[model samples]
Target: GRPPEGMWLPETAVDLETLDIMAELGIKFTILAPRQAHKVRKIGQKSWQDVSDGRIDPTTPYRLNLASGRTITLFFYDGPISRALAFEDLLERGENLVARLMSAFSEDRTWPQPVHVATDGETYGHHHSHGDMALAWSFP
Candidate 1:
């Protein structure tokens, strides 16, 4: 009922050309792996802080000014937590999953922070035994 707003690239793959295409198509945002973010900086600022170590603040969405003069927002999901959920034994207990998700936020910050976990679709019912049950328990 509405115009498209976002696009998810296969394998989370991304490049400037793809980004420009998305922007031209009026796509507002996309999710990306934290490692894909090379640098970041405050809006309207000149300096960029390198995220080569893969440590990025997942709380805020960053604006990418593309070469086409169109902008797109990027959200970098938490890599380690996503990996733990998909590969580690996190789904063995729903409580463990909840705890890990909670730890991603900051307690003192007045503003809200996002805990984005991007993982394979098979992670729900195939990757770990009873993972779908664990996910349901975590939410409820």
Candidate 2:
């Protein structure tokens, strides 16, 4: 098998030092919670717009430059949708899951967007009954 290009941090927790270490190790990307992002700016731009309030646009990945002169891509998952799937029983029905997932897309954006949902694996068989089935059905 090929080596991993990304890593998932425990509990989605992160710090700059850890990120720098990951970049040093050749890890190209990692997923994070929306609240983890303090600010963002376009690639190669200097200005960073604040997103510390957890209002980041979760549809696209952002680049984080490390102090070591290395950079890593950060992909923040949709917090509200992930919470809904975990706590609001969105996984109870496949249709509901599909609908909720679809709602994440913005029709106004011309660029491509990805809806990344980071939830516990147990959410399927352990947390919600038949959640595995619902998730599989949603993909089809």
Candidate 3:
């Protein structure tokens, strides 16, 4: 089968039906706020008309396999952590921030996954003064 027209929607505010539409069009995966996954009740269910319970699991990613057999993997960003790093003055000093962030996951020593930090691109410029420079200096 041929691929359908590709379109990008900002904010990606989509429901189950929207996902179904995308699946029908052959969309493989999409990044969206975890809130969007709220409507997902058992696996393989469709219809975004249902409301979510407002609880989101951030450890693993969620997948929605459409009738077409094409799977859409959804990753729920850590809204609280991202917002804190962006809006709050938590990570004022880049070195301190990096140390704290690294120390958080390093406690286990056995943990295999690497620790990471993600935030709005503008956070470096708009939120914190010299934030970009701080990040650059803190890294390596």
| Number of the top-ranking candidate, with TM-score as the measure | 2
What ordering of candidates by TM-score runs from best to worst? 2, 1, 3
Q: Which stretches of candidate 3 lie above 4 Å from their native place?
A: 1-9, 17-28, 39-53, 99-118, 137-139
Worst 10 residues of 1 by lDDT: 106-115
Model 3 TM-score? 0.59
Query: 1-140, model 1: which lDDT tens digit per residue?
Result: 99999988877998999999999989999989988988999877899899978898888888998887999999989999999998898899999999999999888766779889888888988988789999999998
lDDT of 2 by residue, 86-130 (tens): 999898899999999999998898889999998899999799999
Q: What is the per-residue lDDT of model 3 for residues 49-118, given as tens digits with 9 covering 90 to 100?
A: 4436535544445677667566666655555555667877655777766765554453344435333345
After superposition on all C-alphas, the RMSD of every candidate to the true structure, in Å, is 1.3, 1.1, 6.2
Return the candidate ranking by lDDT, descending. Answer: 2, 1, 3
Evaluated against the true structure, the overall lDDT of model 2 is 0.93
For lDDT, candidate 1 versus 2, the one ahead is 2
Clashes of each: 0, 0, 1
| Residue 127, model 3: Cα distance from true site in angstroms | 2.5
